[model samples]
Target chain A: MSARRIVALSGGVGGAKLADGLMRVLPQDTLTVVVNTGDDFRHLGLHISPDIDTVLYTLCGLANPETGWGRRNETWQFMQALASLGGETWFRLGDADLAMHIERTRRLDSGQKLSSIVADCAHRLGIRAEVLPMTDAPVRTRVDTTEGRLDFQDYFVRRQCAPVVSGLRYDGAARAEPVHSAVAAIRSAAAILICPSNPYLSIAPMLAVPGLRQALRDAEAPVIAVSPLINGAAVKGPTAKIMAELGLPVCAPEIARHYGDLIDGFVLDERDAALADQIDIPVCLADTLMKDIDDRERVARASLAFAERLRAEMIA
Target chain B: MSARRIVALSGGVGGAKLADGLMRVLPQDTLTVVVNTGDDFRHLGLHISPDIDTVLYTLCGLANPETGWGRRNETWQFMQALASLGGETWFRLGDADLAMHIERTRRLDSGQKLSSIVADCAHRLGIRAEVLPMTDAPVRTRVDTTEGRLDFQDYFVRRQCAPVVSGLRYDGAARAEPVHSAVAAIRSAAAILICPSNPYLSIAPMLAVPGLRQALRDAEAPVIAVSPLINGAAVKGPTAKIMAELGLPVCAPEIARHYGDLIDGFVLDERDAALADQIDIPVCLADTLMKDIDDRERVARASLAFAERLRAEMIA
Candidate 1:
């Protein structure tokens, strides 16, 4: 098969896994991951981009396999010290992981844009693929929980996701301009794949950026989304809980409907084959449970094939 | 003796030891240490007050006994990670010590004054003595070396004090305002004791601040200084090297001479008693090596008694 430029829209952990799969199956320098920066927040006075770091570590094979987040063999001395100092320690930042936040904060303070810093970090860490923040400007996700309005990190880390999330908003998304490089990547991609991340939490924030979805619509390629659930349950995080809290059924069809016409195809796990027929969009079933590198590559290949089939059908 | 408020001027390590000694010997809340901020530089975009921290750690009994710097049992994971990320790692910031820098930087960024932050930290850490930065404003020490002019930390840490010191200047001393509490502490002090810190590098920066020496002169209390040298050599750091580079002899007499008109008396180590009678104002000898806790308390008592002697003579 000929090498093609693939663009992946993703969030943290779960999404990073599929992005890793794409990196493994795809050729070098042919992948571009536009990660959601809505989860980016200031922690301990340092700029922390959770999803960007997740994807960077995943693609570079530096992520902890067990946690599926942060760096492997990480130390927690910094967090311990912070706790001892009576500082906020709910969001545990590992010592090695702190380097990312410190460097990012320093550069950001010095007027460097997030995209440039990410690019430089990627290059320095020997990441072959391009990993971009969705927007350089602040676009923090504010979770409207049953307890009241809280920042994304407050709801997720500090509250331990106990607060029932009713609604979410990307605070600065309306005014935030999409990254030029991300838009260019989408415009020229052979196919754009949305990873198995929470539809409302991750993917929607990216689409909320004005002209971002328009870039997808204007692109001369098929756009596909992978269902985040396996057997009607999310592998990790509050995806399932958030869905139930919003009074929506936790199923593949609902995720497909959430994406709607923006996607040309939707890929579900093999266990959810029955639900695939219920989705109005063109649907494909594959093994979406990416437990290992080989499993990820397999799912990535199947998803790409499904995208190619949709493109062929449109041409016919 | 009745409890009397005492003001102490200090720098780092060596000064911190004597400050700790003062804390041990004096009544609670009787001591206020005005630490030099000239060595404070923005490293990795964090506001780090080294001398201020040393004072805080020492008074609170949190300092590493061997290094006489930073918190006890500190971990270097952050420094290791920073180095791996290609960050400037010449000045090693331990994981526990990083909390101080991060918190300080955050508060400073939010427009909180350094003196207020130090006071709060000292209170939190259970330090009975007050710890104050020399000034609220930036008063950086710049060393004019044979190699060229360099920032304090750049010369002290990165260059390992190898540069031949030609001169020293406090960059913002003239424009920097003295902390109101420190000035008040000096004016109302029962006695003022200058710790065994480098004359040019440490204590000089404090004196360089306009009206600081005036406050000492205006006070009715006597002022005394402890020599950093034991015999003819400094206990640690570049005190001897800088003294030699500046064409000054490294001896207790030179240090006493440096404090000439400012000090009412001078305190030299018992080992340097042989060289003390070279036409000095008033001199006292005590154990100044400070190898252990008892040594610290002993020196503190002797220095305070010397201040009392000077006060008695002035009254007579």
Candidate 2:
């Protein structure tokens, strides 16, 4: 058998946690993370890629353990100073975290592709695992809320997801081609893992990109999704609320159904083990709440094991 | 007499200290500082106005006392993180200082004039003294060096002003009109004071503008210049070296001669009082080294007194 190469699709915090776990469990060079750039926006003349930063920070051990986003030992002096200047400070930019935005924005302005910049930044930060943006082009996730269509950051950061999400649209995603590196990673992967990020806000945007979802569906790797929801509630973000708003059942099976036939197996929290029978595909139950590095690794291992089981079943 | 409405033309640290001193002594609404914008540059996609910021920070009491530039109690986490990402770090940008750059850049991108942004920032920072850029138009200082022509920051910052100066030119200054506020300040002023800043590098750039120099020459008020030089040397910067390289004497008279016909009086440091006789204009000798806030105020007061003497002489 060929060496195990796992590809993970991730959003900001929750997905970053699982991606970090996968990096720890898998060989140094075997893990490739395709991070969502749907949350990327220009704020205060900065190209802010929230999800990509979260993933990079997580994988490189720079992530704030408490908040699960931003860099550890972060200082809010930038935001404080910005606020004093009457600058828009609704979206907090920590001093350390600002480096990424500024450097990325600079690189972007200098004509470097986002994927190449992310790859270089990851390498510089000493992350052995490859990190790629979903696409090199812009793909903003617009949340169509009762308050009208709000930009992803407007809904997520500024408004704190207060407005009821009526629908979601990935603007430019249909035209945005998946980055070649990401497509190659998916194609050659031994297994693919859909991390426990908001299915709608995070993973769906990547799926919306032209040929990205189709590539994942066509990949020979056994695909498994870790449920962001456990016991009909999201551990983080507005995944549960979005699911409820969309008139879908806020459960692991519904999450599986959301992914549909793209995933061969599903990993749910042990708390949702009763719904295993309802999941059309094979299901693995584990404690999916990644509170610590240990829990992340455990959940990561379970997801990989589930993928292996499905691979075996397919072969039989 | 008309509330001592004074207009001071300034550069970076040296000029800013005097501007701050003038602000402290004069009525809150009396002093209008016109700062050189020749040092403004776009680095890492942030529009940085070194002299304007120096004047702003110094006047607002936010300047670092030790360095005489940037914000007091500034953080360097941004630079550290930026370095790790292999971003340019030749020009050190403190974290707190970055807010000004980012905010200014954003506002500039939004089509707001630089003078308006500076005024808004000053007002927000509790600064009562009006701070105006020399012009809204781009006027970059280029140093003609032995190493060939270099951008002002490239010469001053990156190279540490090491290259032997051949000449200096203010690009676009010939067509650049002085900002309306600065012109109005100069026109209505009781006296126009030229702060003790580099003649070739700072004040010259403002003077290079089409109508700005003529405005000073034709003003109703007496124009007085405080010499940047003391005892054949500058207290800071490469002003002395540039003066010597250009085949000019590095003394108070040289500084006076450089601003000939535009000024009615020149203020020289007490150390160079021996050369006071060589100055064509009435010369006032004072301790011009602004080592502290007290020193700044004393120098500012002396400049004002000299300007008053010149004004009286003009009336006589």
Candidate 3:
């Protein structure tokens, strides 16, 4: 098969690292990344897709290495001024990073399609990767926490994810139709890879989009999921705590099972290699700790090699 | 009168300089500046009041000297990306500057009044001088030109003011009422000083507001207009070129005629002192060249000193 096309699913930081790895291995235009829009929120009247921006900025070499999100060398003068002005500034908006949100919000207001604007933003940032939103429709990941149902930002930023999430719901998911690029990527894929992101908060929202999950399930391509949970903890964010809260084991097999029939194969970190046999799906063990650019590239190569092996088995 | 309250009418850039001077020289709460809003435009879905911000930044000690607009220490990454995105970025948005506009737009979208927002902005910037918009209504300065009518920004920035001005019109002024602060400033003022800004583009728009000119004409305050024209050239901007284009002499007395019965006095540059004797109103001559901070203070002091003389004449 002529250099196989691959589609990857992602959220923000953790997902972006794997996505970056995939980009390093895959040929230009060979990879299509479908990012979760569940974390998307309007802040200061600007439409901000945190995950999408993280992926885009990481791919474009603009992301801050220390934070693993937002642009490098970002200034907080605006936020400082906003705070001084008694404006709501819970979600920190870096000066350089804010321009993207502002332009996106502006274009969205001017009747442009979200996908087109995303494409425009990617092109402006000089990113070559195909970054697609899960859907054009707005889907908010609402957390029904102990503090009451709060918006994703309120739960994540305002409360510092301190609120115990009793349950999570992707608002507006029922009507969300997958974007044409997303569907096209899946249908024509050589393989589909799920990046190590929060399954409930990130991956679920994309799957919840009408017909998206079914498209992946029915595709001839092998579907591989990179476990976000390593050993007994989440590499980042609240995935492990959230899993425990929802009465699930904080292990690789548990995360693999979370995908159910949607995943044909799984990649677990070396730390969780011992538990790989417990999962029904074919599993590969590799170092998934993408701590730096080199680590990202190494993990990406392993994921690509794993996908290749799975695809060969599917052909056999 | 208790130390003579001073009200200054202003727009962006050139107006901000005098406003800065007034802020330095005038006692706290002694000056009320009614800034023009015709140059205000919505960019990236944010309501940007250029003149208001100019006055605010200048008064707060933040105006960039090199550009004569925007904040000091501003970064242009946002504008660079904005241009790359194929967005209409003729009006440059510096990264730091974008934050203020974004937050202001957000607050305005939340149904907050522009007056209150400006007040909050001034207070946050630690500016004691009152900065008020000429009117809260959406009024744009449209240039009726040989190249066809264009918005103020289009005429000024996009076209680089290359278009031959046939006439200038305030598109929404007939329906716009002066904001309460502007009216209150005019009514209770001990003296009203019009900054040496472009007459047709800046000051006329303020005057165009339905009853604003009438309010100034009837105010008990001695209204003084500083001539933007000096030595057959404008102190700043296209005042002289536009004046000549409109079939009027590029002279100080012509500015006096433009204001007509609205003023009790006029201030001219030393170069135009000879023509002051021929004007209908009482006139004063001073350097009126605000080249730096000290110059700004000098011009401000001179204007106030002139106001004092006008006040003394009225009292006598």
Candidate 4:
């Protein structure tokens, strides 16, 4: 139990919140966060991994409290100057957060793997827990919108997610190799936690990577999921809107169903306690709305306890 | 004289100040500045042309008054974050100034010529005077120092001019073609004025270009040089230090001798009035230390008047 290796799959803000909670509660260096790299795109010739940065910044206590992405106290001088120079200003990169893209780009140019760079950054940022990118390959998330096909950032930032997201696809996922460390972490984990990130955007990209889904399916640990939605809406992002747009019920039951047979247990918000019976998986009701550090730790402890109970039931 | 078409050869701070003066005193859109691009280098994969930026910033009135480089009130959040991520920090790039590097790199990657990018930036910055790089091709200034050979920025910024200079070379200058606009400006010029910048580091790089020196040699208009040294010392940079290291007398006479047959007239500092008789070219004694806008304008007016006098004599 002291040596328990807790593995979590994450996207950006919401997922990073839970990931930070787990890192704090779990034994030092026990938590391995596999962040989705599908949100990464080349902007102004610099490779930007939005989700990876969100996770890294959160774990380091540098995440902006208001936005939940980018560094706290970040300056917009770079953005203002960039616009004046007529450079691409659609996706705004704050001065402090730009370091990740620039350093990552420089490392990638010199033939370093994305996972290694993430590991180094996490270590440097004084985070004991490991933060790994889902895959080193270029697996971009492309949304099929009513306004025609658009890149992830184009839809999310430039268009403000105004267009209806009918369908989503990971452009290079078919050939993207699951980062070896991520797959290895899953296979040896005492418990696996699916973070409260967007189902279609965040967690799906990791599942899309070859061999990753299979590794999770065969893991001996009890797999658990904390639903991103509380009641019928997400606390952040367009998860609820996108779910409705895709013709799916925007509730915890639907989210549990999305993960299907891969997860053995689910943590649903207290507000959705009545809908717990609708989920086929072993479900537990908890306050999943993580507004502060206390709430994050509470949700994390409850989810881990649920995983323990599910493991006990399986052994029986 | 309404369409005077004055052309100036420049490097960084000192040269840019004089260029700014010319821009202010001369008719709008009549001055074309041919800047040394040999100080350009690829740092962190960004193409940084230090001298070109200095001129551009100075001309646009965006240059830092304190440092004489970079933008006023620039933030260093990028540098701090970059250092935290283990990125190179020797070359201090302020956040606001980073826009030029990032935008120029993006444009260069997309197959835009260096001269065209400069023109576009000048227009966007509302610069009435044309600013052109001496050449479109990659011509890097390599310093032959006592420590060893080093790139321009490596010697200038990183080393802080600690290394003793033995010689200098402009790599790729032999095959480099002068920018068409710059060559055209020289060919159709009313007069040519050389700015008060380091002769070995700044002005020599432009002279090293294949047809530029020859064009200056063959121009029908009078070519005059404003001496960088005043009272046996440069107002800024390593001009005096490098001159002593190169076994040359640190005086206006040495600068005039360095230009030799390329210049028809020389603007000696008032302090070096005795050295004017030693110079073979037509010499005008004037105060050359430009501490403020008024000083820059005064020096610029004196140089132009000297050029006018040389032109009048040539016609007679």
Candidate 5:
């Protein structure tokens, strides 16, 4: 069959880059992106899902290339006005970005599922690839830190992620079942790819969804993951800092260790190619930091080629 | 006593203009504006008082002069995005305007009264003119039309006031008592001046609140109303069309008759000077169209002079 189904797991920005790459290389309907909702929260009475917006913006080519998130040419009038009115605008949701939140909140209030809202948004933005939330239910990533247990945005934006992370928990993950489309996409996939995103913050929350992790383990398709950590640093965000704060080694091998049996094949940065033997899973090395549109596409092509090679080896 | 007090009853846009003029002429604490809240509605799950914001924006000098409402130099990126997402953008709420709605909604949801939120907003904007809503309760102005009864905005905005008005009704006015500050200002004023706003649509709702009309009648102050129907047309909005549809003449005397015993003095346009003598109330004629800031100030000066003249006549 010509239908080559590829399911990609993603968070915001960094992960969205890989998801974009995968979408570019694969056929339109061949790709399904399951986004992390751990960073989702209600702000100003609107349900704001940060990672979902990022993935949608990235896929539709509306995301700001400079910031790697939010819409390009976005205005801060709303945030400035919000600050003037004493509204908590620490998360910096831009004016154009707010429309998405408002519409999503309205839809949710009208009893539409998060997955359906995302799918509709993606479709309206001319995105042919499916976009699905990890779960239909609310699940937040809470950082159990020395200061206290902080909500994802409270720790990330309000405190500037300065708190020392003792551990992380996907609050309500036990009750969250994977969205039917998300599960079907994974089960029907010829190959599954986990985008290079923060293990503790992004990917873990999705993996923590009860039936999700087990479904991946039981899937017929081989699961491949690209390391977010390269050498001793993350390409972006506080992934490396968080890993170090958690007393975990800040290296590619440690990223592989974090995933454990969830990953059947692993891709690491060329800088950490020498450390491949130390990683338990079979590995490939490539440049994973997607700086431009071409870079995103190349990284995606590289990941898919590497995954196919691994699948061939498994068959042999 | 250098503590001269001036009380003005107002609605949005035209009312805001007079309130702004009053703030410019009087001492900060001397002026009190009782704004109509009948236009207020919950939209996108946010409690939005259009008249309150209009007064606030005008007083802050942040109001758009061209439209006579909303913030100046506002961007519609959010509204454009909202339209793209199939959300309602008929209200033309700019991003900065959305901030006000969002903040108001947030405070309203936090168990704060509408009166307190308006006070907080006024305090934040450095407006000391005591901007108070007609009532804290939710009172929607519903127009009984040939097309059927529709919400105020739906009749005024969505349909562009094209529907013929049979009558107007204040939905919750029967149970609503006037705000204490509003009642106190009316009772304490040496003279009460109503702004040049629609008598039926804008001022009628304010009068409809239980016991407010009686309070106005009982107050020792001489009440004066600036005619919204100047000459044979409304300065702005649908007042003329509504008057014609409701079988009332589109002229200043007809406007004065609507207020009847509620007002002791009437201010009309120079074009409507001939019709002024037809009314029983004491009448003054001058340029009432606020074409510019200078016009607003000039009209305000005239209105104040007329009020003092009426006060003298009452004493005589």
Candidate 6:
């Protein structure tokens, strides 16, 4: 068989780690990453694409290793000065990370699409894999909480995700057209992998875009998803809390049910191997916790291998 | 006599220094500084008012002592990152100083007037003296050079003022109205001291505003100007070079002539005392070199005293 081309739908941090691993394992230019833009917002008059930046930084080897967000060795001089001026300091913007926002804001204001800007930035950063935003149009993730609707950043950064999320809404998703590159990549893909990110907060936003879910459902490739939850808890972020708040079981089977028939195979953590039989789809048990680059590559390999098994079963 | 209320029209750097001096010597709420906004431009999607920021930083004791502009303890991480991303780095925005630009741009985008924003910033910075922009309206300074017309920052910062300035234009000044605070300050002023800023590049922009020049002319206060030139040289910036390029004599008399009938008195450097006979206005010779806070206060005191002398002459 010819080399497989893989398209991965990702959010920030966790997703970025796996995307990086996939880039390492896949042939150059064979892996395409479609990042969630639902966390994008305007802060301090600059367009801030949190998830896109995280993915780009992670792929370009500039992401902070400690936090898995922002640039490594980032300085807080911008935030310090901003605070001195009595400006908003809640959503921290590092000095190095601010460049992306300022430049993106300038280009966006000058009428350039976000996808084109991201492509140019990725090219400049020397990333071989194609990194595409889910959509060029604005798609903000609003979290409905007990305190009412809070912007994604407000809910995540400002409030520290304290409010119990009642429901989630992708503000502009219905009207936003999926970026042409993403659709094209999906259409030609040999396998589609959904990275282990917050399923409701990250993947759901991309799925909310009118035709994107349908596109995934219609893709010829075997679709596989890595569970964000290992046992009954998310490794990071508000995924588990949001899941419990939404009255859903916080487990691998639930994650599979979340994707339903869209995913042909699901990768579950070895720790949660016992729960594999409960999942309706074809499942692979592996050490899904990506603690470092090695683990990331291992998980990525297992995911691709699982997709290959599913494709073989379909052919048989 | 009642305590004098002074109003100063200033540009950047040199003008800001003297304004700081005046603020130190003058009683609370007795001094109002009207800053030139002609150098204001939208850079990287942020409104950058060079002169106004300098004045604000200077007056609030936040300006860099070495640079005479921007904030002290500034970090260049933002610029470094910006350069890496192929963003514009010619007009350097320091990490600490960027807060001013971002905040100002945010407020401006929200339809707030420039004057109100300046006032709020000054208040937040703990500045007691009133700081006002010359006009609330947009009035960009465009330099007509040997290389053709260029925007103020393009000529001043990007080109390092290397272009031979043939002439200057305040693009929107003709239709711009002076800010109400500035007009009010000038109308009721005991003296209007013109700071030692570039006559052509700085003060000329303010004068270009339709009614501003007329208002200065009709003010009951004696209009006194401090010469930016001494011994045929500018203390800083391209003032002397611009003067020579425009074929004007590089001396205090030429500075006085530039101001023409608007001034009743002129403050010249002690080194230029011999040239006093050539000036039409009453001239006060002092050490105009403001190397420190003491020098700034001394020069400020001399300017005010000279204005008082001119007021006495007017009464006689």
TM-score rank order: 4, 2, 6, 5, 1, 3
Query: Once superposed on the true structure, which residue ranges of model 4 sit more than 4 Å away at CA?
Result: none
Model 1 Cα lDDT, one tens digit per residue, A1-316: 3587899999998888888888888888999999999999997789999999999998888898887678899888777766666778888788788888898888898899999999988888888889999999899899998799999989888888999988999999999999999999998888999999888888889999987888998888899999899988998888889999999998889988888888999998889998877888888888888888898888889988998888888789
How far off is residue B98 in model 5, in Å?
1.6
Question: Which residue pairs in model 2 clash with each other?
Answer: none
Task: Write one digit per residue (lDDT tens) for candidate 2, span A1-316.
Answer: 2367899999989999999888888876999999899999999988999999999999899999877678999998888899899989888888989989999998899999999999999999999899999999899999998999999999998899999999999999999999998899899888999999998999999999968998898999898899998899988889888888888887889999989999998898899889999998888889999889999999888888888878888878
TM-score for each model: 0.96, 0.98, 0.95, 0.99, 0.97, 0.97
- Give the per-residue lDDT digits (tens) of candidate 4, residues A121-155: 99999998999999998999999999999999999
* lDDT minimum window of 10 residues, candidate 5 chain B: B1-10
- The prediction achieving the highest DockQ against the true structure is 2
* Candidate 5 lDDT, B1-316, residue by residue in tens: 1356788889888888888887787766888898898888877766778888989999888998888678899899998998888887778888999889988888888888888889888989989789899898878999999999999989987898998899999999988988988888888887788898778888889999976777789878788898887768887888899989999888889988989888999988888888977898788888988877778787787888898888888889
Q: Tell me the tens digit of each residue's lDDT in model 3 across A1-316.
A: 3566789999999999888888877787688889999999888788999999999988888888887678888777777766766778778878767777877887888898888888878877767678889888999999998779999989888887898889999999988899988888899998888999989889999988876887898889889999888788887899988888888887889888889988989999999888988899899899999888889888888877888889898899
Q: Report the number of the highest-lDDT candidate.
A: 4
TM of chain B vs. native, candidate 4: 0.99
> How much is the lDDT of residue A239 in candidate 6?
90
Native interface contacts retained, candidate 4: 0.83
- Candidate 2: misplaced stretches above 4 Å? none
- C-alpha lDDT (0 to 100) for residue A273 of candidate 1: 90
Candidate 4 residue pairs in backbone clash: none
Residue B227 shift from truth in candidate 1, angstroms: 0.6
Q: TM-score, chain B only, every model?
A: 0.98, 0.98, 0.96, 0.99, 0.96, 0.98
Q: Candidate 1 or 3, higher DockQ?
A: 1
TM-score-best of 5 and 6:
6
- Provide per-model DockQ scores: 0.63, 0.89, 0.52, 0.87, 0.81, 0.80
Q: Output the better candidate (1/6) by lDDT.
A: 6
